[model samples]
Target: MNSTQQWQNVTWFEVDEHQDGQRIDNFLFSRLKGVPKSRIYRLIREGQVRVNKKRIKAETKLAIGDQIRVAPIRYEIKEETDAPVSDKVAQSLLSRIVYEDEGLMVVNKPSGIAVHGGSCVAYGLIEGLRAASGKKYLELIHRIDRDTSGLVMISKKRSTLKLLQDLLREHKIKKTYVAVVKGQVSLDKQLINAPLLRYELANGERRVCVSKDGKESKTQWNVQERFMHGTLVHASPLSGRTHQIRVHGLSIGHPLIGDDKYGHETTYKGPKPRRLCLHAMRLEIPGYAPIEAPMPEDMQSLVAQLRAQKADKVVVSDKDDE
Candidate 1:
């Protein structure tokens, strides 16, 4: 297979067993090196790419023996000036790996770093790992938001990726997140069942809201600790919708602290948070022991401050009674 720049004639590919079940867009990404993702998507949308002699969507899955046609398109060849991953960044990513095996790896991702690169991000965790470890097949099994940090799984083999994704779709894998919300929670445990709709604004910013005409979403929230102003809670999302925990927490009037998107300004003004107070604490997968990431130092410090403030208020109230 020739690279995109070298292609002058139309090309045909037969999907073999290894290539079966992969999305058309992803297949194009792998084969058409140096081709921008936007260009590939445009080609698919313009009917320039076809499968089985018919136009197909980008997400269309390929089957064994499927014939794919790639029409020739010219793109300006640009210099490959992508910077090499620095040693410091590479070591930082290496030290965050909690578990690793031949098939998969569980990384305790840090906040403010994206799981994979796209859009304006030049390189993300997966790209850094690939450069550092020289692993060509490493791919993200799931994604956590850039501002939210915690356990992210990377599959080393395509078979493992397929298996884990199937498990996720069947609701067999369990994911637990810890977050600190704006207000105190009275309930010991609560089930948030709401339908969520995802839409884009005129400025192209994506947002999710609870609406009747939406997909069913559920999150099991349990209070872990209480403060006078904030509540630290464990959130287990039953459905993997975008921003499930954040939207559910907002629906219940306790948006996550430091969540600029869904949270409102609160009257409690003890300590300001630096980032979104959400973390993927634990993940439970069948046939494997639970994988856990300890609370980050920033969150721990915030929780301790809240606890101290609560203690001070208790002492003041007692003094007043006396």
Candidate 2:
């Protein structure tokens, strides 16, 4: 629980022209810095947040000249530091920027770091980048799960953000991931065309599963290496959906190594990977040079082990045939 100071008061905000078409929830999040998203949703649900004196849903769009009322709430406020993020996280994120120009930035996002601050995360990648860049229009172009490390795009201009979003929706942006799975990928090349549905568990955790009534999703995968215990595969998602790559990787009976959400505890028999062995290795935008991220150290170590063991197995097979 937050130890909030009581101020039985309300604050009113007038929507500006530039803020038009923004979701009420997002607008509130931008205004109420350091407040948890759950609390914002609660405020809307309890009729504490009103637009033009009428209760509105979280997804309601804001228009110019509309009045927003926010009831007094308890929240924790932290003092601003020199850096927008902690020193350790800030340094890590700064070092990972692969490409940046006047209107765009690309980063090799590390595993276990959220792209945006939400849920239990206090300050995320975007927040750190914004604090470092001192830019007024920086925003995310797309999102990936916290556990999945890979190429992430950040737009420094609103026009660039809109253009990149349109490209992603049209499947024009080419993104590729390198993943190590528990079993040998049966096909050299395979395409998974499954529909996925997002659902919340009883404990409120979000999860995605394949269902007949879900939205169409497709992923193309090609084997990079076949190991005795696992395989290194390159995966490309044709349709952008939450957990599309992870779930589609599971459909072929080769669940990703260290993927706790969809793979079993006993999934891998080789050296255990430190985290999910998935990396966004490559990204191609229409008007930009292709950006590639090298394999992280942890994944490299695991791959070396797989390669050594695979070599030994091949030698043993040769002797047995003789």
Candidate 3:
């Protein structure tokens, strides 16, 4: 129980002996009597519900003697598909676009914006995209980590969604990324082969982490530039796995510079780039000519600062060599 919770409403439910091992969200969904499932999932996403007095995942299990506190939620019944999202928000979402055509659109998503709204997001990227284009069938073809900035694919038609999904399955499209990490990496290039599994903590959210139990993932990277404070690298993934780049970067001891959730810390020794220093720099489709997008100005400035620092170190080393 939070020391500062002045709950506007509270519902207490006792765990039955039969439901003792069921996931908290599942248990609540079955026993809450009248609340909508959408609202229940949203409550889990928004940190409103508590199990044993600790905020937890929808998948968390209810144990015996656990005190479940359902917080004060204004449960408004609305279609999950028709939640209110406006066109202007979709137009604003245009700033993230990397490439677009009739069949597919690729967006350079920001670090924190979700591609699709789930129970907690309320309004998702597609909701805005739907309002912006006024297209009824717009859909996301693939997934990206919520905290990673990069190329996201969207389909204009349901048939197109299947086509594009097939392309991804066949590895028909190629995506490239650039990431700044905390190291002086010396290797020109290497391949990282690892597997990932969704890891859930006792009371926190779930995240993808490397494990023997995970699915196969592969990544190739080359050190574009190295600095005393870190290394900037170009990344190419052969397989699209959740958090593959971020996890591989961290595994190699060079977590993305500002990825606090995965990278551990944000501040650097030199100039600071405010967001996660990762960018979807290029995309190549099997049939079309390659499309390249340069790093956003914010990330470019940080790279310049790192190179300048590297030059200063080089000058000092050269003078010593002389």
Name the lDDT value of residue 115 in candidate 2: 78
Single out the weakest 10-residue window by summed lDDT for candidate 1: 313-322
TM-score of 1: 0.81
Pairs that clash in candidate 1: none
Q: Which stretches in model 3 have alpha-carbon errors above 4 Å? A: 1-88, 265-268, 311-322
TM-score of each: 0.81, 0.80, 0.69
**Where is model 1 more than 4 Å wrong at Cα?**
1-79, 266-268, 311-322
Q: Tens digit of lDDT per residue, candidate 3, span 1-322?
A: 1122132468877765544445565466434424545567668877778877778986575666788888775543444345555555666688667678887787777677766654345555766677777776566777676666677777765456556666777888888899888766556677878888865555445568889999888888877787878888998888877678888888777788877668666345867768888877777777777877777777888888888874423221212110
lDDT of each candidate versus the true structure: 0.82, 0.80, 0.70
**Ten-residue stretch with the least lDDT total in model 3:** 313-322
Q: Which candidate, 1 or 2, has the higher lDDT?
A: 1
**lDDT for each residue of candidate 2 in 1-322, tens digit (9 for 90 to 100):** 3334444468899987555655688677767765677678778878999999999986676788999999988665545552256667667778899999988899999999887775567677888877766677667778888889989998776567667877887899999999999877656777788999876666556678889988999998887888989889999999988888888877767888988898665456788779999999999899888999998999999999988884323221212110
> Which candidate tops TM-score?
1
RMSD of each: 6.3, 5.9, 10.8
